[model samples]
Target chain A: MSLLSVRSLRVTYGGIEAVRGIDLDVAEGELVALIGANGAGKTTTLKALSGMVRPAGGRVTYKGIDVTGMASHHLIRQGIALVPEGRGVFARLTVEENLAMGAYTRNDPPGVSADLDRVFELFPRLSERRAQVAGTLSGGEQQMLAIGRAMMSRPRLMLLDEPSMGLAPLMVQKIFEVIQSISAQGVTILLVEQNALLALEAANRGYVMESGAITMEDAASALLESPQVREAYLGQ
Target chain B: MDIFLQQIINGLTLGSVYAIVALGYTMVYGIVQLINFAHGEVVMVGAMVALWVITALAGSGTTLPPLVIVLIGTLCAIPACMAVGYAMERIAYRPLRNAPRLAPLITAIGISIILQHLAMLIWSRNPLAFPQIISNPVFHLGGATISGVQIAIISLSLLMMAALTLLVYRTKLGVAMRATSENPEIAGLMGIDVNRVISITFVIGAALAAVAGVMVGTYYGIAHYTMGALLGMKAFSAAVLGGIGNLAGAMLGGMLLGVVEALGTGYIGNLTDLCHVSWISSDLAERCAVDGHVILFGSNYQDVFAFVVLILVLVFRPSGLLGERVSDRA
Candidate 1:
């Protein structure tokens, strides 16, 4: 059974539809990528699935339970976490505090402490600047902190949005490596990215979205080699 | 020199009250960006509750110790104010949270009006004389005199501010509050219940305001339905002066504003005397002078000084003396 299943999810902002009747599923331990251009409803779908945006229609099930319209914090307790678009680090908080906040729902102090160490080990730069305010960190460091924070939640499923946006190539490469490592650790991932090539390469399976609907879905290698995908997304 | 020292003491005492109240404004604004104009009404409610409790106890001829009576009064006031603060957030502020910024602000004003009228309806418009809970003799410090009440006000304010600082910077709850203030959406994603954190913020802020309200009433020996209006405006100005979202900034701003007003009231006439404005006609200058000093300004103009400081701070350092804790717009 899939870890997460969204059937005909819809989201609207103001009077306009953003994500319209889209369905998707992520099996346990699979790294699935959703690739689309700007305004293709990729972020909105992620938001709706994570409960940040309430779906105007359809059901969201997690682990075969109907978890539709559940609050974000509730979803976190059920082992779902979203590292939001633009790396939403608490700017006024120190790096250490941001990581601490990531473990907010957990009451196990010793476990939290161990997780904290693990996160620091995962991102050594965050450890180096643990006491520094997050706002002062560089964009790459902030992105790292965002991912490290999500790891502190010990989520079974992680939704990553635009992890490569506005980063230098080296930093993007480092981030993709981290994503690969996280997936290898048996955490299911649903990644949304406009960088189609990198996302498809990192993911086991990929789905193409256009105008608020999925246009194609296949194994990542197949999509990577497809002539249509190459013409539109790979810029080859 | 003695008069100058005396004004400083007076200023510090008044400043402490403003600082405590200003904290309420700063904390609430930091999290929700709501002005909570009704916050002033919370202060009034606190003072009224304290007054009612103390009066009832006294009327019943309960011979409690003065310290115990004051403590009980404060204990009563804090919770009452907290309830009002919580209700304001849940009933008036929460539903309008997603509405345009103007909606909550206008609702806050409406809440303030309702609170004022409710107090007036219950407690009446007459100013009740606040009983002296601490009647200790005044002490002398060099040239300036210190009343037991003034010392209590200053020390308590400092203690509360210290406790608040520790709470905001040291505890897990403080981290959650700060996180929510920084970005509610992201904080939610991190599994922090933003609404709970925000509600707690309002409660803490209201508790502080309650203490200030009780202190102000005790200091002035009067409590009335309308007393919070001017005091609230001054405290709000202090919050702005310190940088609306900065805690330490609010403290500094409150004290600075208090000192300026006190000093301005004491010396404005003398200061004006030193400045000879040629624009003033000789007849008018003569009429404005009292005992060879131009008395264009006096203690009556003390309130004006707060507004002047506010305007000056707005024009010069809009971010406040301490820069505001503004989050990055995602």
Candidate 2:
């Protein structure tokens, strides 16, 4: 069974429909990329899956449980964590405190502490400035902290939204490398990105979304070589 | 010199009460940005609850130790006021959370009115004498005389403020509260229960207000339905003066306002007398002296000083003495 299954998912913002209808599936331990243009509903789909937005219509099942419309916090307990769009770090909190909050739903203190160490190892920059307030961190560091915070939750399935949104090219490369390592650790990932080339390079399978619908799904390498994808996304 | 010392003590006591109440305003404002005008009514309810509990216990003809009686009254009042605060949030404020900013504020005023009337209906408009649980044993510090009650008020208020500071800055729950205050939507995305955190903020604020209410009653030896009105406004001013959303700012603002009022009360008369203003004229001064009053300004004008300080603070540093915390977005 797939780890997450979304069938005909639809989301609306007031009178406008942001996500018309889409179907997708992620098996356990698969790294899937949802790549699209600015308004192709990639972010909306991620929001719906993470329970940030209620779907206008659709069934979202996680591990065979109908978990659609469950509140985001509840979803976290079920081992789903979203590292939200634009890296929403708690700016007022210290970096260490931000990581501690990531483990909020859990009760095992020793396990939480171990996860804290693991997050620090994953993002050494966060460890170097753990005592510093998160707001003062540079953009790249903030993104790293955002990702590290999600990792602290020990999620079985991680949803990353625009992880490389506004970063130096070098920082973007580092973030994608971290993503590949996280995927290698056996965590299923659904990564949403406008940086299609990097996302496809890092993902095992890729879905191309345009105007609220999936236009194509194929192996990442195959899509990278496809003429239409090369012309539209890879800028070849 | 003795009067100066005495006024300092008085100022500290009054400031502590304002600090406690201001914390409620600051915390609620920090989390939801709601003025919570009903907060004053919560304080009134707390005092009334304590009064009722004490009155009931007294009427039972079983004499309990003074400390135990006061403790029981406080314990009962705290929870009663917490329930009122929780209900106010859930029923009046929560529904209007997504409404325009003015909606929750107006609802808060409406709640304040409802609570005031409810207390008046239950306790009547007459002022009730608070039981003297702590004896007033006078002790001299330098030239000023201090009472046991005053010491208790000052020490307890300081202790509570310290504990609250530690809770906000040091605990796991504190992190959640700060995160929610920083950004509710993001905090929820981070797996924090935003609603529960907001509710807890109200509960903590209400509990602090209740303690302040009981302390005010004990200090003044009287509890009245209208007592919270002026106190609440003063505490609100204190919160704004210290920066509405800053915790340390609230405490500082409260104490500063108290000290200013106390010192003004103590010295305004003497200062006016020494000035010998031409506007008063020699003849008017002579007549005033004949009437056993030589000064144009007196303790009656002490309350004015608080407003003047508030205005100056607002005009000069609208963000407050301590800078206000701005919610940073991604």
Candidate 3:
């Protein structure tokens, strides 16, 4: 059974439909990439899944429960976490505080502390700047902190939105490696990205989204070779 | 020199009161970006509740110690004001949270008016003299006399501010609050209950307002429905003066404003009286010469100083003295 399955899910913003009856699935432990151009309703879809925005229509089931339109905090408590677009780290808070906030729902102090150390282990640069205010960090460092902070939640499924957005090539490479490492640790991931090739290469499977609907879905390598995807997304 | 010392002491006492009240404004503003114009009314509510409790207690002829009666009064006031504050958020402000920014502001003013009237109806329009039941011993140092009331206000304000600072920077809930203030949606994604944080913010702010209310009433020996209007405005100005969302800035702004007002009042008469304004008008100059003084303004204009500093701060540094660089982003 799929860990997360969506049936004809629709999302609207200000009377305009952003996600149009899109069906998708992510089985447990699989890395799924939702790739699309800008304004392809990718972010909105993630927003709906994470309960940031109310779904205008349809059903979203996680682990066989109909969890449509749950509050963000409720979804988060059920082991779902979103690294929102633009890396929304609390700017004025220190890096340590940011990570601590990620574990706000957890009451097990020792376990949370352990998870925090694990996050620090994964991102040494974040460990070095743990005491620094998040606002002062560079864009790359902020993205790293954002991911590390999300990891502190010890989520079962992680939704990443454009982790590579606005980062240098080297930084993007570093981030993708960290993401693949996270997936290897048995946490399911649904990565949304504008960078088609990068997302597809890191993903186990891929879906092509355009104009608020899914156009195609295939193995990551198959999507990489598709003529339509090559002409439109891969810049061939 | 003695006068200078005395004025400084007076200023410290007054500034601490302003600081305490200003924290309420800043904390609520920081979490929810609402000025909460009715916050002063919450202070008024605190004072009124304290007055009611003390009056009832004192009249009942209970054997409770004087200090115990005062403490009971404060205990009663804190929860009452907190309830008032929470209701204001849940009923008036929360419904308008996503409405146009101007909507909440107008609603704030409406709540302020409503609260003032409600207080008037409950407490009667006449000012109630807050009973000074406990014995207070005054202290003297360096030719300046500091009353026990002044000492209590200053020390209590300092203690509260310190505790608040520790709470915000150290605790789990504090981090959740900071997160929610920064981004409510993202904070919710981390399983932090944003609404609960906001409600708690209002409650904490109201608690501080309660203490400040009691302090203001005790210092002046009276409580009136209208007292909160000017006090609230002054505290709001102090919050803005210290950078609205920054905690430390609010405290600094409060103390500085207090000192400035005190010093301005102390010297405005002296400076204006000695001035020879021949350029203003020949008649005025002649009058000054005949009377040997201008005597333009005095302690009655002390309220003018707070507004003047506010205008000057707005004109020169609108972001406030400690306003952070908000442009930093990912």
Candidate 4:
């Protein structure tokens, strides 16, 4: 059984449906990527899975239990964390405080501390400026803090929404490397990104979404070589 | 020198009261971002309730001590004001949260008016005098006249401000409050109940304002339905004068504004014809030629001076004395 299963997830904003009956599943310890253009419902799918957006109709099953409309924070406690788009760091809080806030639900003091050290190790820049307010950080540093914060939650499934968005090319590579390292440590990753080439290269499996529906699903290797995906998204 | 000392003490006493009341305005604005115009009415409610406590004790005829009665009054007023605050948030403000921001503001104004009338209808527009024993206690300090009421007001205000500062900075609730103020949606995603935090913020702010109300009532020996209007406006100005969302800034602004007003009144308003009109138009070297003195203004214009300072402060430093940068989230 897959560690997470989202079946026929449908989310609407007023009369407009953002995610239209999409089905996706994340196996335990698997690296899956969802790639799409702007407004292609990639974000909507992540939000539905994290319970930030209530699905109008569908089932979000994590570890065989249906958790469709659970509150987002409650889901975080249950081991799912979503690093929201636009790098939603608490701009006023220091980097350390931001990390502490992410671990709010966890009371295991030693484990949380160890995880903090680990995050700092992974993103040494965050450790260097641990006392700095997140808002003042450069785009790359803020993205690192955002990802590090989600890691502090010790999530079983990390839903990353465009971790590479607005990042320098080198920083983009670094972020993907971190994603790879995180997945290698038995943490399942469901990465949503517009950087189709990098995301597919880093991911084992890929799903291409267009206008609120998944139009293609294939192994990352197949999607990389496909003429249609290349002509449409990779800007061949 | 003695008179100056006395005025300074008096300013400190009054400044403490404004500091306490200003905190309520600041905290409510900090979390919910609502001006909560009905907050002044919460103070009026406190005074009325305290009056009732005094009356109940006195009517019982010698069983409960006066201090016990005062405590009872405080307890009654705190909860009463808190309930009113919670109701205001839940009923009047919560429904309009998603509506235009101006809608809640208008509703807040309407609530303020309703509360004023409600105070009049219940308290009958007659200002109730606080008990004589509590109101008239006096102490002489080194040629400076200090009253027991003033001491209590000062001490109580300090204690409340200290407690509020601790609550904002030290506790888990405080952490949640800061988070809510910073970003409600993100705070919610982290398991903090944003709505409940906001409601609690209003309740706590209202409760503190109630404490200020009771103190003002006891110190002045009178509680009137309309008492909160001017005080509320002043407290609101104090909040803005000190960066509104900054808690420490509110206290600092309140005390500073109080002292400035006192100095202006003491030196400027009370001075009669001390300013020779020739001095106004003359250089320092030519000032000796002035003959007649002209009165610029009168002490009754204290409120106008306060507003003038307020305008100057606004013009120069639009963010207030303490600058706290706000993120444009909503």
The recovered share of true contacts, given per candidate in order, is 0.89, 0.75, 0.98, 0.50
| Candidate 1: tens digits of C-alpha lDDT, residues B137-242 | 7999998899999999999999999999999999999999999988898888888889999999999999998999899989999999998888888999999899
Candidate 1, residue A60: how far the Cα is off, in Å: 1.2
- Candidate 2 scores an iRMS of 1.0
Candidate 4 accuracy as TM-score: 0.90
lDDT of 2 by residue, B201-261 (tens): 9999999999898889888999988888888888999998898889999999999889889
* Chain A TM-score by candidate, in order: 0.98, 0.98, 0.99, 0.98
Task: Give me the candidate number with maximum TM-score.
Answer: 2
Evaluated against the true structure, the overall lDDT of model 2 is 0.90
Arrange candidates, best lDDT first. 3, 1, 2, 4
Single out the weakest 10-residue window by summed lDDT for candidate 2 chain B.
B321-330
Q: List the TM values for chain B, per candidate.
A: 0.93, 0.94, 0.94, 0.89
Model 2: docking quality category: high
lDDT of 3 by residue, A93-138 (tens): 9999999988888899999999988988888888999999999999
Please, what are the lDDT tens digits per residue for candidate 4 over residues B191-283? 677789999999998898888888888778889998988778777778778878789878987787777666666667437554444455555
Q: Report the poorest 10 consecutive residues by lDDT, candidate 1 chain B.
A: B321-330
Interface RMSD per candidate (angstroms)? 0.7, 1.0, 0.7, 1.5
Instruction: Single out the weakest 10-residue window by summed lDDT for candidate 4 chain B.
Output: B284-293
Whose DockQ is higher: candidate 3's or candidate 4's?
A: 3
Residue A94 lDDT (model 4): 84
